[model samples]
Target: MIGDTPPEASPSPDASVSTGEKTGADVASAHKPSQPQSTESHAKHAGFWALALGSIGVVFGDIGTSPLYAFKEALHAAAGDGVTRPEILGVVSLALWAMILVVTVKYVGFIMRADNKGEGGVLSLMALAQQAIGKRTAVVFTLGIIGAALFYGDAVITPAMSVLSAVEGLRTIPALENSISNELVLMIAGVMLIGLFAFQSHGTAKVGLLFGPICAVWFASMAALGIGQFIANPQILASINPYYAVKFLSEHGMAGFIVLGAVFLTVTGAEALTADMGHFGRWPIQAAWLFFVLPCLTLNYLGQGALALTVLDASQAAGRPFEEMNWFFEMAPLALRLPLVLLAGMATVVASQAVITGAFSLTQQAIQLGLLPRLNVKRTSETQEGQIFVPQLNTMLLVGVLVVMVTFQTSSALAHAYGLAVTGTMVVTTMMAAIVMRQMWKWGWPRVLAFIVPFMILDLSFLSANMLRFFSGGWLPVLIGACLFTIMATWVRGSGILFEKSRRDSVLLTDLIDMLKARPPHRVPGTAIFLTSDSEVAPVALMHNLKHNKILHEKNIILTVDTRNIPRVHESERITIEKLDEDFKRVTVHYGFMESPNLPKAMGICRKQGLKFDIMATSFFLGRRSVVASATSGMPLWQDRLFIFLMRNATNPTEFFHIPPGRVVELGTQVSV
Candidate 1:
């Protein structure tokens, strides 16, 4: 589906063909019926606590590391007017409520319930909405693409900002301050990022074992440090009241509004929780968030607030500047500062890992949905199908991250670029979730509005605040997101036009069969399988073969593969076979968007349904279209050119479907779109 060709279309001419032969016994042995294999066993044995622990590592990594800079940046944003007690309390209260409202209530309480066949994310939600509406509306599709694009924008900024912020902790150490420069920190962070991406190809199966316990330790340390500070100044707990946030925003005017942009950093990674719902079930993520992540983050932020108040009072009394202080690192005991820095660094790396892998997963989904060009996706873990590596994506992310680090140079500067992407994504998520509530849940208008109106206001408010930063490095994500949106839109539009053109050019399957019967071509001994996109039409390869080779096989099969919107197709419903005539069969195979198609294995399943296959005697016929852009095509000239370029580079069907090269025979033809 990632390729330009439709799922039922023949392979491109560039696809490799196999001429290898397998005897009847070999084919029979290769496809022998065995005990039914169940794909649902992976999560069956995982208890609530086990899954919760796993969720802590993967789902909470990004949000958990926010304590590294969220408070610091928010305070810095307010420091220009000389930090006030009301401002500190108000900012902390705003952050606390943002987390409570945006994440706990909106996503955990509502949106997560809208999973598409146990899958959750923008695309999954889009699919659910489309299914409920009985058709794909342009609005829903565009929202999904925009959300996905913004996620990539967020993905690039996350590693650079998180890692830079964590490593910046070293600047707090007096012993290292003189020796560690910003360049050295950037170099170190760059190396860690390089190493992190380089290891993606190896799969996370081995190291993933340590993510849970390590994050557990990280969270425990956060709570301990925060609790130490909170106990020292118990009054800081009063900031939990919404009144402070209201009073601060009311009194400070534009400055307070602008500070909300920085305050948004507290919940930057909330989307990751929903994005990863399919990996760990909803309850596990919810339990982890409510029990461990939420409390730790709350305590840490409160502790940071308490520490900031003390630092502010002391600085005011001493007539010194509070601008130079890095309260996140300063909250730790002086003796443990270096170790804390190392811990924070490791946690940020874990956060980076989560975001990086999330980008990979999202890209795959987009490809399956026909929203992007094909890239070589390598399954890194044999047991963990979700663990995949996209080499092109990795290189692109690495380059983007490095550029961000080099250009921004510091976490404070990069933070200005970070919130826009997250806020934009949050806004889109709220919008899509609203549609789901109204249309899919079939909720009454009053109930839907009651639930979504408040969340929309909250998300839009955050988005508006983030817009204050558009010129201050926020444009970076917007630029990246816009470009990605264009590419996806162009591909989807072009693919649709091309599909229509192919349909118009194709001959009807019945007519082709009838013509073959009337002509009575030189009968060949082998079985011939023609891959096609439309079952209603005969494949171009079949017609081309008859015209050139002047022969027809003893038996013929037309195969079409359908990628469903669901996460996975059940084995029982995978293959559908119909005997069109004594010499011909129409076989359709259904796969989930989350799955990769395998022709041989699918054919093996058909063996039980009276379909016989002898690899040595069977020949595969594939149509490879050499697409050319034409002025009369429905799409604009630029889009037509882009489509042609994408088609030229698409992964050949031979490799994509895992078809045997030696048994493949490709027929080439040129088509103008």
Candidate 2:
């Protein structure tokens, strides 16, 4: 079992875990990888509740904050002329049941069990599916890319939407409602979101402990709010029946379908459940959702519906218009409403933090798997394996979020775009997961069909419902995802072509060793390590050094760093050494996709095996390539240019690998891809 999961692959020397070959320098990252507990018994462990509490802060934060705008938006959408009692019941029922089926049944019950070696996430699922198939298929690879692209879309919108929705809750306070203008609210949310993003670099280890208790209060307050309304109307509990959801949908034709899109807001962050399973473990997340989170969310929605029902009846009697307010914020009493706003704001910030962290983790996984170019990855915490931050991603996400917030201007408008990426991601996850169930879990065809078909239908229905808003703002996620997918596809295609070109241009390591032995070059004193993707072929840097300098080091190492399909590699299995000749040795270092590739720390492990990797006495040789666009490249000319752009912007290997610059030498080469 590995530590944390995020994504995965590459080949030749790169082909071990998920995909095929990445360049040697791409192996480095900012910090040493931390050891993660592989024990799958978190539920039985002493840290069970602590893990569950952490899950509340980091995992469910996204979905937990949904109540702020979900019912308000759904009710408004379905309320063509006015909200009827039946519509209230229906919207509440739909929201409740969607969470039950999607989050509870699909994710908690089934998807969590499909984890790849104790890791979860769409990419991890892709790796697991590839493992089950005994080879990586185009279908699995495409699905993984689509899911990850959609996630990036989600990552951008979640922060904007959550914060905006929570800040809008200030309108519920009588004192602040009249004082705060819509523009003022946007500015406030903007500042808050910027602050949250700014805080990301500091690492959440210290304050992360507080997340559990805060969310616990948030959930408890939601439950209390619901129960308070239940005192006035106990019959609202009847919305729990599926009959209301089905009946409401059957009666309201187009409007009900449109409401389905808005109802999806309830489960928008459901992916976090599966994505973060590795952080808190499967059991704690499940237990938290099934027991505390589910009940609180269900009750809150019921309370909102009940309050709406009361308002409807009072309006009908008075002959006035039935107004639909932000019922989540209104559920609290007048004096406590401001405090509720403060609490909601805190919860929303926490939600945004979770999505941001997820993005960083996803970036790390994508880079390790060769799906994306290497970025400046920094470790935020020494203790936690999942606490790294990617500066490129952080900046991109912050910009995207601010732009989205400004463009949409309201949580209501942002809601239109929110569900599209999330639903598409769910659909892709559902497909990939079904395959894993059939092949890996060995589920019968009938069982698999029964398990997956309903989810597919539901997800597709949600996706189509969201399509109605495509012209409005729904196209935002679709556009963002498309751009990201193009970039990833281009990178993969470009890297593969470049690797092929290198393989053809390179000499065989075995033959080179034999030739050198027949007529050995002038030997230097210290050890020299040349990183390569293929151990069979001589590294470009090694060849360049020998040809240009006309000398060789006394001791040489052909270092091949592998990112395994799993999340974390055990230290015992981290480094493998094979003696190639008197002067040369082959060293292979293995890391999980979720881990940072700290070469020095990994190499230090070799001392246990009678091979000492002396950092002070070693020289690191890196092959730096200038990738120019070629018309004959496998990718189009435009794509070739895009790949070159990405490569040029990627983090330098000396910094990325945490190698000392003074001890490193880079050999330059040109390649067309």
Candidate 3:
């Protein structure tokens, strides 16, 4: 059985919310510091379905469907074209150990303990590294981002392989022998993938309800299947001995490395457990895994081996055990075989959903961090607070997945492309976990080294194993992910450089006010509030107001709104208004990243708090870098161009921020990073 799930930490910071912090000359200095609270306070609200279904539905996908091929491939690597009973048993034993050590022990038991504020994901970990390690944060941050990008590649492959393998069961079913073809099976998977995305806008609240029970039963059935087989061939139970696993490894020698790819699949969803920690809490997932999942997985893996021994005479069955095995299907009633296939297919769909959701969350964080251009984001379910759908991303992923499915066509072919992306992600997670253990958890050196050493050996083994497939097709996803990562890094760096360069020419508010006093004060009729991108740059519109109109408004408000990841803010944390004398106020609004900033709502909030915003006041601000460009300095040539391309297509913030279109004036500044 997969070992006990590792203990995990809970932190609540979804990357989807844009909460940029700014620094500079014209911008007001100082921000309300994020206060530390009991991490437990950020638990899931009323939408248990979102948590339950999403956690089970989205998070369990990759790992859940892993059993389809993990053992099969492992055996093939060990015994070549044919496997003996002993070899099959040994391979299953090795696979069980890999799952236990990598998934259950490393991730569920240990890595989960590193959540940031109840939100657990790569970026949240990166944020922790920033607070604890300072400049070194970027290194880990980059690695984590690369991991996240690689996840996108995994997402592309999971659905392709899982669905195909499940449909391949058609080859096993006697009735569909003539009707099913590889093209037909692939087309079915492609249609299912498309339909899956099409339904995303409607949200998963409805189908999600079925996911847990369905998957629970699916795991139970696999365990049942394995247990029944084991009862018949009890001798195979000896494979669970650690001696079998160690013996297989030492005896196999160099050949063992290739098995790492297959082994990696067993632990694919480890990160998801941590990523979904905010939804289900630490205990439920752990409980579900330890008591329910582990036993079932172990039982099923053993059963597969037990069944393999009956027909294939272990030595000749290594390359394709299922093709040689009669017991796996023959032992089951015909009526139940199709059900198992359906269950496997559904499990694969769930796995794909989890990766898709992760992608959405990651994209949101990239935008907020200025690493990515803004996109139109919609919350899919009212009840499921974290349920979100991105239309553009949805279409893009759908197309990418379809192209891959069509091109690869078979699960075995797609397998060549699978492990590299997930392995890279695993490596990145370990590196970040090491940072968290040392810095945030304040673990001693011995404890930190103990955790990372074994994990690194395992992770690198998979990475190296996957490298064998790079030229064969594995390079596709890595290349795609790396290119995508470069685009994000470039845009972020470019924007930062532009923001910095603008500060030199900007005037300070206090100094600007002094300059206004020396000139004749001709007043505009009403108050004017200027929106700014940076805390350091002065609003160019304010300067425009001075030079052209020769006057400042009767009341001027310098407003900076910061969106943070916490769900809700305390009343004391809402609006901080500092008087600057002569009807001028510097207003800073702190919004939970999950909450949208409504100008009208916020204006009313200010009204209730005694900060007067004259109804007639029109906001004037310089909106800098409305478009991102690839200046050679910040990002590479292609990335700068790509950033510009994405920026040009991005939705204008004017509509997104809920500002009055006509009343708000936009002053654009060109920026190249």
Root-mean-square deviation of each candidate, in angstroms? 7.5, 6.3, 8.5
* Quality of model 1 by C-alpha lDDT: 0.83
Task: Give the TM-score of each candidate.
Answer: 0.93, 0.93, 0.86
Question: Positional deviation of 212 in candidate 1, in angstroms?
Answer: 0.8
Query: In candidate 2, how many Å is residue 527 off?
Result: 1.4
Candidate 1 lDDT by residue in tens digits, 92-147: 99889889998899888887887766677777776666666656678878898999
Model 2 Cα lDDT, one tens digit per residue, 1-673: 0111122243223222222222212243223265233433342354667788889988989999999988999999998878778788889999999998898888887788887656788888877777677666789989999999999999999999999998898888888879989899899999998898888889888878888899999999999998888778877778889999999999998988999999999999999988897787777788889889999988888888888888888999999999878898888989999889899989988899999999988888888877888788999888888888887788889999999999999999999999999999999999988988888678899999998889999999999999998988999999999999999988887777777788899999999999999999999888999987777789889999999999999889998877777777778788989999888899988887788888878777877788865678899998888878888647889998998898888888778777788999899889888
- Provide the clashing-pair count of each candidate structure: 12, 9, 41
How do all the candidates rank in terms of lDDT, highest first? 2, 1, 3
Query: Candidate 2: where is the Cα deviation over 4 Å?
Result: 1-46, 612-614
Better of 1 and 3 by TM-score: 1
Residue 60's lDDT within candidate 2 is 88
- Candidate 1 has a TM-score of 0.93
> 19, model 3: CA deviation in Å?
24
Determine which window of 10 residues in candidate 2 has minimal summed lDDT: 1-10
